[model samples]
Target: MDTAREFLENITAADQGDRVSRLRFAPHKPHAEPSFYEYSVLRGVRVESVRCGSTLYCSFTVPARLIDRNGKLSAGAIASLVDEIGAAAIHKCGKPMDVSVDMSIAYISDAKMNDELEITSRCLGQRGSYHSTGVLIRNRTTGEIVAQGRHSLFSLPATASKL
Candidate 1:
């Protein structure tokens, strides 16, 4: 029995990987720029366009750094994209960003390193301080959907946000 191979195969990738995790085997860097998690998950994203203060488009290439042992994009990376891009859709410049209240993601397929992607986010609407947005992530070359997400947000009252 190859116990070493079995051991290596048994390590499932986590949202926060084991090596650089603050809560796991590593100590705080105190000055890691953008931090490892953000760099791995979000660093290379390119903003394509924004419209009406409610729609956003972006482009990304799945980087190897965010891939798991099986060569698939990590679920956490997809979730982070949905959360950050979804919030950007409804955000008006010069306004404090709304807080994420809920998020639901449907992961559709595997995306590998260097796969080009198109990410689109649109504001669904708002009722008072509550708002909803949807984000779609798809393969730019093959037109296959990789994930869909819906996010809900809540705006803080002006009085409560005063500095």
Candidate 2:
């Protein structure tokens, strides 16, 4: 179909080269400097409390770097927060670091720079090597739910199996 051909054209070699050529790759100045992405995201995050080693409460303020051109917090940033907070809930409960296998998110509202947000994550349950967690992001100022997420991870055994 013409529709399929048109879509495919967008990802052609020429188009791919064009897209890559436009990107600016700038490395951080010093090797000693912390990764910019991690520093930006982790800064201003405050852990308010933890209970049962499976629930966590934290607060953060939307920062300018994470704001999209539309003047709202970027959805990607919200997803990253969900992954971090949700995984922490499981790891703090004495589980080994696991590889995330699935994640689902619902974006309910928008947030602007400097808006305070409350992030809560709790373990739903686990079976075998699988663990599930739920995360909710709420606007602390307006009491509006910004997003909700569910994350699932697969934790492998510490040692290799004979098979």
Candidate 3:
């Protein structure tokens, strides 16, 4: 089996532009059932790039369902987006899949419904079994920052059976 790092490197070695475009068009498989979170919170989100290394980028068009009573994107939805993207970046950086130790988000500005958002996440660093990642969400058209988030994750140890 390929190591996580190797798998990500192979993906990055392919045609990057094509890969990004493909993700842009089809964020999820048509035949697969959406996960509960995806169905509820990420219906209109797209994966812009899943590049190897410590960084990844995604996009979403804010839909009515994700809007708050104040006519802006809901805080909970933004937090969920940040958490998901941060985990993706950590995975690409070769961190073993594990639960989040902590996550924090700071809402900088408001994005109204129908606004397009660009989310960029970067794995800051890792120490032993802990990984840290940062994410920034911005308005796609105006380049205004909407929110910023940080995540700390605990890496799982490889099972003896796998070894």
Top candidate, metric TM-score = 1
Regions more than 4 Å wrong, model 1 = 1-36, 161-163
Candidate 3 has its poorest 10 consecutive residues by lDDT at 1-10
Which run of 10 residues does model 2 get worst, by summed lDDT?
1-10
| Positional deviation of residue 136's Cα in model 3 after best superposition, in angstroms | 0.4
Per-residue lDDT of candidate 3, residues 54-153 (tens digit): 7888898998868888999999999988877788787733433557899999999999999999999999999977899999999999999999999998
lDDT for model 2, on a 0 to 1 scale?
Answer: 0.83
TM-score of each: 0.75, 0.74, 0.71
Note the Cα lDDT for every prediction shown.
0.83, 0.83, 0.79
How far out, in Å, is residue 16 in model 2?
A: 16
> Which portions of model 3 miss their true places by more than 4 Å?
1-34, 92-97, 160-163
The residue pairs in collision within model 3 are none
lDDT by residue (51-124, candidate 2, tens digit) is 98599999999988689999998999988888878888888344445778999999999999999999999999
Residues 36-151, candidate 1: write the lDDT tens digits: 45554678899999887589999999987679889999998999999889988887666767889999999999899999999999999899889999999999999999999999
Supply every candidate's count of residue pairs whose N, Cα or C atoms clash at under 3 angstroms.
Answer: 0, 0, 0
